[model samples]
Each structure stands twice: as structure tokens, then as C-alpha cells.
Target: MTAERIPFNSYLALPEGKEFSVKFKERFPFSVNAFGLNIQHNFSDKYYMAPDKAGVEILVLGHIYDPFSGRSGEDAVLEIVEMYSESKERFYDILAKCSGRFVVFVGGKKMLEILPDACASLPVNYFSPAVVNDSNEFAVSSHAYFIREAFSLPLCSNVRSLSSTRFYHLGIRHCPADMTEVEGVKVLTPNLSLTYRAGELRAQRIFPRSNRLERDVNEVINEVSRVLLSSVDCLAWFRKPIFCALSGGVDSRMTLAATVGQRDNFQFFTFAGEGNARRDLLCTKKLSQLLSLRFEEIQLSNVHPSEEFSVLYHGLQGETRAPNVKDTFARQQYFGVNDNFEVRSSISEVSRSFVRRKFHTAEMALTADAMVPIYKRVPFSRKWHELIRQEFATWMERSSFRDVEKYGYDWLDFYYWEIRVGTWQALVLQDADYYTNPTVLFNNRKLIELMLSAPEKYRKDDTLQVMIMSTLDGDVLKTPIVKNFGKKAWFREILESSYLKAYQALIAR
Candidate 1:
């Protein structure tokens, strides 16, 4: 972690996406050889390299909580080699078994290109963070946010850039994995790009398998409990106080319920006004009392909007801009006084979010637009649509989710977890010293795979989540859901749209 290796805001991506390309080397200090430019200044804390095998280099900017496997540093490297040697198909099986939060770097001669982990918890943003691989060098970082934050690069807000931004927000990286060769350099997608001199490319989460172990409600509860409990134990915060954002909703309630018998190290908290326990606070307080845990309500009525915006700006390093949501970041940072560890039930709602409650298309089919509400869409030219189609195809291939009809139409689960949760929430929380969800903390890939693999019927209507919460305290099943989009919510949305780009920002893809 020397001064020379301080990780900058973003990487320099040449021929920037499908729209425009600016020579950033003119503004920044770096060279662009066919291979790649070598920019030494970085912000990595630890570096893990496998000299004995592929000579892969893994630089950990954040923490890696691989407690269950009992592996760290070089040992983890050796395990990677063995996994690569064993089967390319099962690479993530071993990867998921080793739980941690990291923006990993594994590069060498054996592996032509240096690839970051598929699910990076740091160096992330709301939109897709990209990595560029050229003939001789490797470059990586969050693209748009990086450019804006780092060099103050003025970006295009035309239809193409707008569509690009929207797609990137939905987990499609700024640079497509198609790798349109421009002067021997390949601007690769950030999510598990399987191109290079590698033997073969195997997408991690292909189709959901028929692994329905939780055939009954009891089984579902136990499995959910196991995943959450294991996730809690997987954190590196030994003997530290655990903080959880307790909302009045089922998502956080289910998370709290998982820690039912193990409440010694737990603390339930809510955020609202000075004394008004409405919506999030009211529901959270009632449940906290029922659970017999101290309801520490953090009143944000006194906090200034300027203070919140400041925390958010630095917190995300200018990745996402939401003055409206900045309060959450500020409040979390405020309550979470120390760097113990925290839990956030982020994607717990994705399994049953506004996107997944019903099918978008009339045919009950999932399309590129149906993934999530892509804001601010503009008319696409022929070439632009072609590029978008290419991007969509690439997204389908990488996800291993070929058919939404066969597996499930709830693509929002993946969208929320990969793009929104990892990029926005986890990225900022990690910076604020709050480690997120158990499925991530523990890297509980088995449980994740199982949950994803379950039939749509079992997955829908918050079936698993309700079972877990009700099992713990059925009274909470009746807890009023904080209506974020109710009569009171529309004003906020209208205000946001008006203050923002209005139609351009409000255009849902």
C-alpha cells in the first residue's frame, strides 16, 4: 500500500464504449501500448500472487473473509491453481466456497489477460465498472464514474450514452465482452469475461439446476437459517458488535429472524426523524421490541442534506449521485461508529421486488428491458440498437441464463445483486466500514445456487423469506410494509424526476 500504488478513481478506457473515444493519456499520466499501459499508483492494501503456477497476481483492496476454508494469501492462490487444473467448469464452485469481499487481480503468462473476480465488492459503482485488456497490458476500473471523478471528463448524454448508462446500471458493463478489436486492444466487460488465451470459457451461473432441497416450508426455513447464520460467522469481525439495518419490511425482518437464537452479538437499528417513528422506523421499532433487542433509532431529522451529500460523494467516490438517498449513507456511517461489521439484507428483496412481482411482457417472457427499470431512454439509431442487441446477447451468455422462461423470469434478482447491491450499496458500505450481506460475507454459493435454482413458485411471493420471519415471530408477518411508492412516495419520485433530467432520467427501458 505505498503512495505509488494508490488506487485511483477509475481506469482509462480508450475508444470509450460505442459512442466516443478521447485520448486520456493527454490529460492523465499513462502510456497506451498495444498490451496495456502501466499506471503504478494504486490503492490496494494486500497483493496475492501465484508464482508457482500461472503467476497470477491478486491484489486485495478490501477484505477477504475466507474463514470456513481456512485459506489466506498464498494458500488461496494454490487452491486456485488446483481448481483451474481440475476443471474450468467448477472454477466458481471453489471460488464461492472461499468467502470474502475483494476486487481480486489474477494475471500472468499462463493466463494471457488479468481477470478480476466476477462479483467484485469494491472498486464498484451503480453502473457497470469496466476492465480493458490490450495486446501487452491490462487496465481496469469503474468506467463512467472513474472518468467523471478522475479527469473531470465531460461525457456524452445523447441517446447512445444514455442507453449505455442505462444498460450499465443494469449490470451490462460499459465495454461489451464482444471485444471489438481496435488497434489490437480489447476493451472487455467487467463481469467474468472468458476470452483471452484461456483454454475455455464456462459461465458460472448458467441455468438454474433442479436442486430443490427445500421441498417443504420447514426445510426452507432451516436452509435460510443456515445460510444467514453461516454468513454471520464468516465475517472476519471476531467478537465485534454486529450492526443490522432493521427495516419494518420482510427483507430486514427475515435477516433479523435468522439471528434468532444467536442474539448475544446482535443489535437492531432504525433510521427516521427526531421522534417520528413513521414508516421504516415505526415498523422497525415494533419488531425490535418484539424481538426484545434494544431498538436504537437513529434520528436523521437534525442531519443536514449537505452533510449527507458530502459523505455520499466521498463514500462512493462519485460512482452514484443520489442526494435523495445520501441520507442512508450518512445515517449508516453515523450509527456505525467503529469498524466492527454490519449486515444488509440487500438482494433479499430482489427475489420479490417490484420487477419480479409480475412479468413485464404480455407473453410472460423476460426481455432485456424487463431486467430492471432502465431510466432515461432515448431513441436508438440502427447501429445503436445493433450494439445494444450485441450487448444483450453478451449479457445472456455471461449469466448462463439463456432462457428466462425455463429457469425463472426474475432476472431482477441477478440485476439487483450484481449491479445495484454490489456496485452501489456494498461498495459504499465497505468504504464506510460496514461489511454487507451473509450470502456475500460467507460466499455461500451453494445456498445462493439453491435459492436461484428453486422453482419460480417456491421463489415467488417471498415464500422463503416469509417462512423464515414467521417461524421466528409470526407477529412480524403482519407488520405493515413501509410503502416506498405510496401516495407520499410519488411526490419524492416526481421531485427527483423534475430536479433531475425529467423525461431523460425518468425514461424506463
Candidate 2:
């Protein structure tokens, strides 16, 4: 018998009524409905499982790699299923070791659990109403539009009215980690698991199981390098001709170094039209020549708006701002047409003190007002500011800040991990799922924690990435890092470094 085929941009629907189910059925003819839920997705048979003797069904959307066992695709899925069947704690531990961009759905007769990857990189949004329905109706989808459309929820008035430029300036690239443009449709933040059972929906953190351990920097770097190489190897097993996104930045460089063993199966490329595209191209070309590797430049031109673009743009429901529309569209077009996997270093920022200011410290009291300046890059109306403040407060409360403190984790680093990379970068990947596949090596929870275990000084100076590159292949660093736009940019870079050093000295004193 021929196997079933699932398309891209899949969604899981558990409608409140039969009417919505019919709509979903019509939209996705190749879906499975059982245990009071319906799942329609684009994953292959390797990523899916039928209901077993225990009446449990599993579906894994996107790629997953088991670094411990060096498993990928079907084998990894089976390993996950076995671990999950054993116990939730074992499953969570396995998840911590695995690296990829995926969301796992385990559905049984009376309960359903939605587990996103460490960074929530695949974007899981569910309809969480103000009032409970006796039916225990719930809907979760990678695309928030599915939930909004199924529930017929109205767009948030505050978000819909903003112009595209204003939207971009407000830095509202996507909704807050916990919010969606559609009312009651909230995003599942990283390190948290959501459960729907007995007419109750609950979300709880699944990480930071113990207090932070300040490990030796060399030890952390050595372990991280080993895990990253394993991750790249696993990815290479599932997909061939992988493209490492080469850039002048440390993140991409570190990723490039990880591909050393799998260089034959990998190529390097940089997208044109990005802010540092030129510098990236030059650096990538030099590295390719030095390393004797294959390289390509993907020009972002001749990209006219299309009906599909319109659908995708609107489907985001104001989550993605206007300025990024074209870039997003073009990249999707390239990846969708070419059918290539792109390796990204987006999640690595968590290890490098991203979104952190020198003044911020572990001892500083965290509040919504204090976070506002860090979260927003541009000015907004008083109303918008207040709304954002409220969102931050809610996020802090929902994320269990008290637990973060108890775990001895720095609130600022945790914020960058959960709010910035977990939410922002995850949404970006979800949008990219429309056309292409992007994987991050640092998406593993254990790896991220290891990177974070290093002292703040090492993280601030890009020491983690530097050490990783040095360990993997020190020659890659022979080329100076990209300093874009000549003297002005150089001066700005020096000034920023100087300020950070000065601030650190003051704090030490």
C-alpha cells in the first residue's frame, strides 16, 4: 500500500463544534481525526505515528536530531516515542538532548500534550479562551491563522490599526512571546509544555530543573563543540547538500565550523540585500577559498509581489511587520523553489548576552517598566507603551520568574533566551516554514544551558563562539570578522566595545 502524503504548513485542530471540523476537513483532505482531535500536516511518514495499542498517536512536525544516539528521521521519532511512553521526565530529558526545529503532538483518549522544541522554534499557538467550554475544545497550529479562522476570532484592534512602517518601527516584528494578534490565541513560549486534559489547559516550564551551575569555560566549550558536531552530523544524515548560512558574524562562523566533518554534504551561501550582505559575501568568498569549500550567492531581486505572498503576509495577522515582508517573501521563494535546507545560527545569540545592557545584572530587580526599554527599539504612543508594559508583566508572571530566581538563573539572560530568541526567532522560523526548512545547531536545551553556564564575561566578549570556532578549525578565524561600512561602522564597533568595558569596570569597582 502507498503511504499517505502530507503537505507543508500543517495545523492541528480540535474545534468546538462540527462546523469547524468540516471546514478543516475540507481544507486538509489527508488528515487523521481521532481521540477527539484532528491533525493535518506536511510531515512525511517518518515523522508521524499511528495510534498504537494504548490509543496514543504521535506526530512530529519538522526535523529532529538525537545527538545522544546519533539518530535522525524515523529512528529518532521512534526513540522519542519509546522515551515518552516510559515517562514524561525521561521524555523531557531526551528532548533536552535533541536538537532541531519541531513540535511534537502526543494525543491519547483523555489527554493531549503539545511539546515544542527547546526554543519553540516551530511556533505553537493555541486558542486559550477567557472562559472554559465544557467540551474541552482546544485548537493549536503552527500557523496562528488556522486557530483564528477556526474560532472566528476578531483581530486585536490595537494591532490591526497600526501602519506597516509604524508596526516595524515599534519593533513589533511578531506579537509578544505569549500573545497573538487574534484574541485568546496565545503563543507557547520556550521551555514550557502545554497540556489539555479534563477540560483544563495548563502551561508549565519544563527546563531549569535545577539551580544554575557555573562550569569551567573550557569544559563548557568542549562539550558544546561535541554536541554541535553531532547535531550537524544528524542533520546531514536526514538532508543532503545542506547550506550553512555564511556571514561575517560569529554565530554563522561557529555554525560553519561545525560543518567541518560534513563539508562534502554542505555548501555555504549568503543572501543578498541584507544589511551586511556585502561584507558577508566577501567574508564567505574568502573563507570558501581558504577552506576549499563550495559557495553561492543568492541574489534577492526580481521578486514581485504575488497572490501567495499576499496570503502569507495577511496570514501572519500582523505578526510580521511590513518592512520584512519583501525579504521574507523572497527568501521563501528561493528556498521553496530550490528545496534546500539552510542552517542558521539565530539561536546562538542566547549565549552571547544578546539584548542585554551593561547596566543589567543578576541582582537587579526585574520589572515590566525595566524591560520596556530593552524590548522596544522605537517610540510608540502612550497606549501602546502601556499595553506592551502589561504584556511584559504578564509574560514575566506566566514564565514563572520566581522559579527563575530560585534556579539562580540571571533574569536578563533568561529574558533573552525565552523572550527574544525563543519567541522572536521562533516566529521567524515558523514563517519560513511556508517555503523552506531552517535548522539551528544551538536549539538544543542542554547545549544552550551549557553555553549559558559560562561566566557573563565570556558570553559578553563572544568567547563561546570564538572558542568553539577555535576548537573546531582555528584557521576559519584567520579572516578578520566583518566590519561593515568602513570607518563609521568601525568607529561605532570600537565605541560599543569601549563602553561595555568601561561599564564592566565600574560595576566591578
Candidate 3:
């Protein structure tokens, strides 16, 4: 290895005794050439300086899923390297077009990342790994828990608990990323990110959302299938016979359908976590049978309300998608996402049906408390609501989101796809397994833009999903919708709202 002092040799245990080091400035601790070629040093190995060459430096933690073919991490980096002498735009194009669900630290004239694992794992505080301990001094880390242990300090109380609504909202200044919402079909782009140059006072780039609108479900299906096959190859590199994180919903159903001929190579896994998930479990079984694929059911029992339990399958109760899925723990370990890679469908705003009440104003999109009523039981955070507002304002000042309302959709669409699906969901799912989502692959940009830009009427109801899914198996469409499975009493919302208001009033007193 031709690196300087290898960083954190004893602390970061790599399998097979593989070592990595870099010639990065201490300020930029994680830097590697385009080939994922990194050097390790301990002041003892025979080494020589690298010959000056044209390339980009990368410092990434965890495997970075790429939509450009099946290649990932350094392999993908090497391919891009071979195509061109490194330039900021070339690196930017690769990061923007292919990378997903990783902590990236890119260097040259600038740095860029997408839900960086270090800070994504601990959204509120910057984290780093080191050989020694210093309680007061902080660094970036993949596991924030270890940093606290290393310092022998009390668990931090300076950080506020993320409300269920705000779990993956945005990685604000002091809040951990949490996962929420819908407005005129608005969902945050869990993958949208920014670029930074070390000395520059401001970010150099804020990646734009796809704006092309096509009404064809065939295009949607084709793009999804492409992401599936590519992601399957990318994920298979880590684990075998990929398992689809299947559910009864459109996202998972579409994911399965997209696999088409590849069905024999996969095992489908679904879980029942007390609510609509129970319905999802039932429907998934039926769907699995139709596909003639092996299915594994992961059930969550001993139901009770804790900080962890959530009304929404997508909740931000803790650092992971689930806080205490006790029954599924063993199964997850056996399937081992870290040990193996799994692909799941996220950003199901495939249809406008997700938007309960159409929103007309940008302010209402971000500042409306209890934006989603049925999910009101999920903890709400005015702080996060405020953050959403501030983020929109700041983003508008810097990007094209300013005229989001001028489009067929409004600010909500931009926020949801760019911030929620693009960033939040990806970060929240980090704890369970290394996951890939066809819905968010960088290469699916046009499909995504077309989905968002398609006329509102085409998107209304489950028109998009039904059109696509019915083509595969019309019978599957007959399954009961999870949230709407059992009818609720007409007064249910009234009572829930009153109870919530009284509780809030009491808290104020």
C-alpha cells in the first residue's frame, strides 16, 4: 500500500487483514484515487510515492450502490477513471448519476456526499473514527455509539429526540435525521444532496430534481426493471440470491414484477408489525404464491405502544427504520444485510393517491402541522416543521425549487422526492441492512422526473400503479389496501383530533 499513516488501524477492523491509507491532508482524512486504489501505512512498510497521475480522490464508508451497470465502490470508480482524466464535472456526474445510500467524502477542488454514513448514523453531530479518545473533541463516525464509549462520557442529552414525523426530514444543524408526509403528493427526495469545496464559503452545487413528465407506465416499468437488474448485480456482490424486501404495497409489488425472469434467483421477505403490515403480510403471501417464489414471513408481536412503535410502516422512531423488531432480529442476522445486500422499493409516491388533500401553497406544504392526520399519532415536531420551512426558503434562494409551484405539482412534490425519498428514507434504513432502491437509483432520474411531472389526473388515485401492476397480475390488485383494509368509524378522526388538542393544552399548562 502506498499511503501515508494508515488511519485508525486498530480501531477499524477490516476482514482478511486488508488495510487502507491515503495521502490526504489531515483536514481531509479519507482520500483515495479513482480506482478505489488506497494505500496503508504504519511508518514501517517499504513504500514509494505514487507517480503523478490524473485521477479523482474518494473516501467512502460502506458500499456505494451505483446505477451505472452493477459495479459499486472502487470498481465503479475505476471504470469512470478509465473513461476520462478526472475533472469536477466528471466526478459530479458519476456521484449524481450512479451513487446511492452511502457516506461519500469526495476530494479534488470540492467534496460531496449523499447521506454520508458517518453523519447519517448520527445526524445531529459530525462523527469520525480515531485511534485515541478525546471526550470534548468530536470526529465523524459510522457508529456514533462507539465514540461515546471511547470518551467514557454520558449518552448525549444535548440532542433532542426526533419526533416520528421528523425522523428523516432533513439533517438539520442539531437534529438526527428522521423519516414523514404528503401534500399534493409531496414526498422528500431522500437522495438529493449538496457539494462542498473546502475553502468556499458556500456549496458549489445542489443537485436538481428530474422534471421530465411522461404518462407511460411502460417507461416506469422498464426503468424499474433496469434498476432491479443493475441493483441485483450490485447487491449480489455482497450476498447471494437477493431477497426482495417485499410488501403488499405498490412499491414492493412493482419491485417483484420488475424482476420478471429473475424470479427464480430471489427469496421474498415480508413482516407483520401489528397494523397495516398485518394486511401487507397477508397480501404478500398471496402475491408470493402467484409468483411461485419462496417467501419468508417476519412477524412482530407483543404489541404495545413504546417510543418505537409507529402507526406508519415508514417511521422515524430511532436511528433505524425499526427500533425494536425483536422477532425479526434473528432473521435479519441470518440474512445479514451487512453480510449481504438486499433491495427494497421506497418512494411509493408512484401515484398521487399518497397525497390526501391537495396543497396549493408552499407555506402550507412545509408549515402545516399535522400535515398527515391519520399519522397524527406519530410524534410531531414543530422544530422539524420549522426546519422544513427554513430549508425550502434556503433551497429556493439557491436552486430551481423556487418556482416549484409553477409546475403541474407544487413545492410538496419537490420537497418529498428531493428531500424525503431522496435523503430521509435512505438514511433511516441504514441500520437494518445495506439496501438499494430502484426508485432512487441515480440512473432512474428521467423515470422519476416523468413520474413527478406527469399530469395530475394520470397520477390521481392508484392509476399509475394499477396500470403497471395489473399488466403483471390483475388478481394482485384485488388485495385489500393496508391502511384502508378495515373501515374506520366516521368519528374516529374527530375523537383523535380532540384528544390530541386536549393533550397539547395540558402540556402547555
The TM-scores, one per candidate, come to: 0.64, 0.87, 0.60
lDDT tens per residue, model 1, 1-509: 01121123233432222222233333334332222223321222234443445444433333454443656544555675566556754655565554444444444434533333334444322112232322232234443343343333333333235433543453322223222112212222224433333333233442233333434546656665665655555443444567776776667766676676567677767767633465677777776766678668776544554543454344333333333345544554465434345666655654454333432222223454433233112233344445544555566665555443355445556554444544444344433432132223323444555455555676666676776667665666666656543356556545533432332234323
Candidate 3 deviant stretches above 4 angstroms:
1-52, 59-61, 64-75, 79-94, 109-205, 209-239, 272-278, 299-338, 350-409, 422-424, 434-447, 470-509
lDDT of 2 by residue, 1-509 (tens): 01211124466656433455454555554565655676665543227688887777887777888886788887888887888888988888887887877888787758888888888887788876637455457778876777787778887765555334353454346555477777777888888888888877788888887899999999998888888788888987875558777888788888888888988888788776555555777788789899998888778766865765655565653545445667667776676634457778788878776545433333446777556545534243455556667887887777676687789888777877777776678766655555656778888898888998998889876777898899998988989876335446656545544543453344211
As a whole number from 0 to 100, the lDDT of residue 500 in candidate 1 is 27
Clashes of 3: 35
User: Considering lDDT, where higher is better, how would the candidates rank from best to worst?
Assistant: 2, 1, 3
Model 1 weakest 10-residue run by lDDT: 1-10
Across residues 1-509, which tens digit of lDDT does each residue of candidate 3 receive? 12222112101211122232222233124333432223211111111222236334444444455654667656765654444345645554555444444444443434323223211221211222222432222222333332233333343332324333353332221222222221111111333333333422222223443334455566665554466556555655544446667766666666666566556677788865676455677788877777677888875444443222232212222233344444334443344333333555665573353423332211334322323222223334454445444434554544455445544445555555544444444444533432122222222433455455445665655666566555654555666544333345225534555645653444211
TM-score of 2: 0.87
C-alpha-based local distance difference test score of model 3: 0.42
- Runs of candidate 2 exceeding 4 Å displacement: 1-7, 15-29, 50-56, 130-135, 161-172, 274-278, 317-319, 332-339, 357-363, 378-382, 483-509
The TM-score, computed over Cα atoms with residue i paired to residue i, of candidate 3 is: 0.60
User: In terms of TM-score, which candidate is strongest?
Assistant: 2
- Model with the higher TM-score, candidate 1 or 3: 1
